[model samples]
Target: MRLCVEVFNGYRPPAHLRRLARPADAAEVVAQGLVGARRIAELRRPRRPGDRRPKHTTPVAVRRVYLCEPRSGAVEVAVALVTGERTWAMALRLELHQDTWCATTLRLI
Candidate 1:
């Protein structure tokens, strides 16, 4: 079976406080890192927080993804905070390709 890995990182707001910039930003971060059909599937999923209904009323900060191809066998992921309203964060997920199926790495970003 192919090896898989998943990694994630983000800021946790104060108790009861929501991070307005997490959802979109997280998506962008993951997008920048991964490629191929598997990467596309990951982007389609609502992996970011606050990405659900009740869209952001105010223009919350936009988030972005940065991918780095390292010499190691694993993938490197990074998040970029483009706006002042947001900060840098990132998460990663690895999937093992097996018999035309994919297995989750059981990682939370």
Candidate 2:
């Protein structure tokens, strides 16, 4: 989960994760980076002229995480994230590849 937050905050895979992926996965990683960056920008946009910019992001706390069948290597998580007075529901799907976990899905609203 920390890894997910780190990528979302920075919008790119760190060096180690980058090295572990196949070509297609790498492309998705880059695309996700763009999406994450854009989403955060929209979320943190200043509402008024004198307001301060948003701060460095903290990882959204996960309410629950569910593991699928043993060989499936898939995990699903539920997280509620607060944006101002609104609490958004977030769901994520991650898969294990070469013994390392990578996010295969991300959704927030």
Candidate 3:
């Protein structure tokens, strides 16, 4: 979950995290999201002194986490800011693989 916040806010993710998604999904996210996160290649400049909001002014935090299947090792996580124009929620899906939990999918809105 921490990795998700960092990735969305312009930080490099760990190698294993890069493989969290299927190849196609990872490719699309990297091409469309991570690249810009690194450099803001398409970010628009502010038109007035206070037109643009500072990046991540509010704190980012993990709101809640749950074990979807407690006895079986399926986990669900939710993270979002306490205050914002809208809820910036991120959901994660993880399953135990070979005795180790591995994230398989991520959704944000």
**Model 1: per-residue Cα lDDT at residue 31:** 38
Question: Which scores higher on lDDT, 1 or 3?
Answer: 3
* Candidate 2 residue pairs in clash (backbone atoms < 3 Å): none
Poorest stretch of ten by lDDT in candidate 1 = 1-10
| Model 3 per-residue lDDT tens digits across residues 1-109 | 6666565555555343566655545554444335433333123335477797566444344565544554567777665633233345655667777676666666664
Quote each prediction's TM-score. Answer: 0.26, 0.55, 0.56
Candidates ranked, most accurate by lDDT first? 2, 3, 1
**Candidate 1 Cα misplacement greater than 4 A, ranges:** 1-56, 59-62, 71-73, 81-84, 99-109
Query: Candidate 3: where are CA atoms >4 Å away?
Result: 13-16, 19-56, 82-85
Estimate the TM-score for candidate 1: 0.26
Better model by TM-score: candidate 2 vs candidate 3 = 3
Return the top candidate by TM-score. Answer: 3
Worst 10 residues of 2 by lDDT: 11-20
Model 1: how far is 106 from its true place, Å?
9.3
